[model samples]
Target: MEEIDKTFREAVADGRIHGAVLIAKDLTGKVDFSRSYGVRSLREEDPEKRPPMVADTPMRVASCSKFLTSIMVLKCVEMGLANLNGGLEKLLPEVAGLKVLTGFDDAGNPIEREPKSPVLLNSGLCYTLTFPLLQQYRKWQGLEIEQGYDNLDQNFKYPLLFDPGTKWAYGPSLDWCSRVIKRASGLSAEEFLQEHIVEPLGIDSDNMTFELQKHPNMQARRGDMTFRGGHTFTAESSSPGTGVLQYRDEEYWHEDIEPHGGQGIYTSPESYAKVLWSILSNDGKLLKPETRELLFKRALTLEAEKSFDEYCEQFKAFVPGVPVPAEIKHSHSLGGMLTLEDCDGDRWRQEGNLSWSGLPNIMWNIDKRAGMCTIWAFHMKPWGDPICIELGTKFEKAAFMMLKQ
Candidate 1:
């Protein structure tokens, strides 16, 4: 733990990271280590004014929010409110009528046509929308559209990159899934999640809510957002490989949106760890054993798996800072990215581990086989910046060694 702490402090001192929260818990729901390091915001020059990074500091977990969304959707299934294999179009008619984006026209506008088949709920949960589709949605649905269920419904009018079930793409499928959960359960996604998951688990409401209201004690932390330089790192020279790049300043937190099923979560590392523990414990209180298995089991088809692999390769290249072990094969599960094998001879996560991260460099890995779950969180961007990934990897390695001891 000391080494891990030192690594975080060094990164902060060197201006690689602003602050971070790290947590590791073992099989029996016992926390092995939970700590925070660095200042909450580098922008605050006054040491007295800046908040010290603490375990309870709230962070926008970015895509990691998908895990909570998935759990709530699964809970809907457990309660007979929704079906896993049901047609997404049934809940949201916009999904059934989505088109496929073939290419762009002379004016640089998208050209789309009808899809060969309708997308199923199962496929929608795992696949994401293409960039063109998002752009098309903004074009058609109006830029003033808010990011809520209605906005998602309107965005569903955009084209699909591929026939939904034919290939897997990472997009806003879970966001749509959140919409489905809302329709099927007859409750707002946020309310349903609170009633069914957060309150039941005794998790802090402030840590899990979708509302963007600022809290006196739980305000979202600001990221460092600096640029790294080759010879001399300057704010303007910040590249993905270089210094921190701040995306959201303090003002960004004031803007609010409806609970995004895919990425709109604000939580602390300690609060989120409890959700992981529930899965590792397999207590049958939140989900049945069979349902829990669905989370780690390979949920993608052979063709879909191929598509996922290709996308990941491109994704790795796009974000050079994030490291993916070459020996590891990945498949999509209902919960998140599923590891098919131990890439580094089980030096860290075991095979069948469920892992994913948020856009701001927050990461988590649930190694059910090892009865361990670890989370590393910080509010920094561009996602997968090398410094943040290295810190996370170092912490993971240290955690595994501590477990062995």
Candidate 2:
């Protein structure tokens, strides 16, 4: 824990990040480490007004929302309100009706045909917004997507990259899952989370929500989002950063946007840590034992696994921290990526453990073997900021070492 503190302190002192929160806890609750470092905003001129970072500082957790959404969807399964394996046609006709893109026709028009298979609940490639056709169509339609769900219609209009369940492609499929939860349970995504997940876990309602603006307490404590100038993965020679901090939209999306299952949730690291610990410990507080097992189970087909592997290999060049080691055997879990066996690196990650990252350099690890989970929270541009990754790696290594003791 002291090592983690030193790592973050040095990072702050060197101007690598403005503020960050780190939390790690084990199944037995014997090892609980939670701390925050640096200031929330460097721009605040008044010393008293400028707040020091804390465990409850709100952050727009980006794709980390996927992991949280997965939990809510699993709860729906426990209540018999949703089925994890069933086709999504009934729940979300827009997603089900999407065609598969074959290629382009003459005159550069896109060619699409009916899908060869049904889009299952776990099919990550069913409907993606990243496809060229989708992007073209979005531009053509003048689509203004401020929220994850706002892209639903455009996603429906676009073609699927491949037949559903045949390959893995990260997209708004989980956001569509939010729609499924809404239709089946008769509640907005935000309300469902508040009533079931947040309340039962004893997390402060204000600390977790899709609409941060409405929660004045949490919004007031919200940290500023910053980015390193001239530092991007695509650059020919990427440096950690130029040391000049440029600010991004602190509130990334419009406040009026609907709650997206894939992204846009504002939550505190301390609050999120509780959710991960519940899954890691299988505490039966948020989900039943059999139901919680889904998070660790491999949900990818052989063909899909191959595509996922290739994607990971190419993705490694873009980010310093690789969630899935390209050389290691891996597969997609119901919630996130699952390593097929133990991996030795800065730290030892166990087989079948689930993990993922947020867009703004946030990362989480849920290790069942070590009976522990860890989350590193930072608000920065470009998903894999080198400074955040380096310190995050060190923090993880320290946590595992502490577990050994």
Candidate 3:
């Protein structure tokens, strides 16, 4: 792993990234390695004064939260708290009633129509409410919503991009699923996750939480949020694509409503590793064998897989850093992206491996065939930052090579 360390250090020295935490473990327990590089916050110029980024430094993992949330939802399914194939009519009435947003009219009104199919429990995608009608509705209602389950009824007022089960589009479907978990278990999403997932895995609350503001220890250890020059959410920099890492004064983690099941998580690579490890090792402490199989198996229909393939091809333009081979086919698992073929010509992940990423250039993999799982976290943006890609590719290849040895 010397090359991996050297590449990461070089990137930090060159201002390509702020900091990162990488952890790779295998079921055989032969190759266990982890490393933390660079300072957590660049606010302090003096190296001695800056807090060092560690494996447990709390990070707003963004969409990587979905992987954990998906597992929790499945756990609910195993415990009879959720039904994977059930319709959303009872579990989520608002989502169930959502209409299709076909287009607009002469007066600029959103065109709507009832969906031909019912929205099932599995019709989830990472979506944001940017539609004109939905925005107007929220503004008219004076909703001061942040990212949480309380905002779901208001947020999903927008029309579905396509009928559920017809095609795939990334939206707030998982966020709604979180609501289902809550209603079925008769507990808040956070409470259920803590009792079932967190406590069983032996992770400390300080290391993983939905409310970063409440945990001062995690708040203090939180890393700075950095973004590419043209990519900061607040404003576009005059000089974009300069590869400059600018600090953003924004908080993606939230404390309001039930914890977002899709993307509201504050956690560390080490803490999350336990969750991934539990799945990778097939340990019943987290899920049943049948339920765990759901994470690695493909769950998409032929039509959905075709749509998912097109989306992946388009996603490549955004994800320039990953070394996924072009020939590898992708299908959605119950948890995340599952490969139908060996990745990187068998040099990295084998067939049936599951993988996904977050907005801040975080990537994770769970390879049951290889008995290994890995997470590489860099809290910086423009989702597919090249520096992150380079480091992640190196780190993933190195981990796979270690397993081969």
In the range 1-405, model 2's lDDT, one tens digit per residue, is: 776788788888877787788888887766789988988765565646768989988888878999889988998999998887777778988777777777666766667788888876677353332355556545545654222334445434455778887777776778777788899899989999898889989998889998776788886778777677644332333655455765556434346466668786888888999899888877799889998898998988899888777766766644323644678877888788888878874256888778987877888889888888999887776666667777887787788778777
What Cα-based lDDT does every candidate model obtain? 0.70, 0.75, 0.75
List the candidates ranked by TM-score, beginning with the highest: 2, 3, 1
Alpha-carbon RMSD, candidate 1: 4.1
Cα lDDT tens digits for candidate 1, 1-405: 888878788877776776788989887544489988877665566666767877766777768888888888888898898887766656878776667777778786777887676677667322222354455546554653333333555444455777766777777777777788888999998888778777877887877766647444456453333223322111223355663334234433776665668887777777788888888888765688988888988888888888777767765633211355743677878898887877565567878888877766778888987789988887666565667677889898888777666
Deviation from native of the Cα of residue 374 in model 1, angstroms: 0.4
- Lowest lDDT 10-residue stretch of candidate 1: 227-236
Off by over 4 Å in 1: 28-31, 104-111, 124-150, 153-156, 214-217, 220-238, 244-252, 317-322
TM-score winner = 2
Q: Where is the poorest 10-residue window by lDDT in model 3?
A: 232-241
Candidate 3 lDDT at 401 equals 90
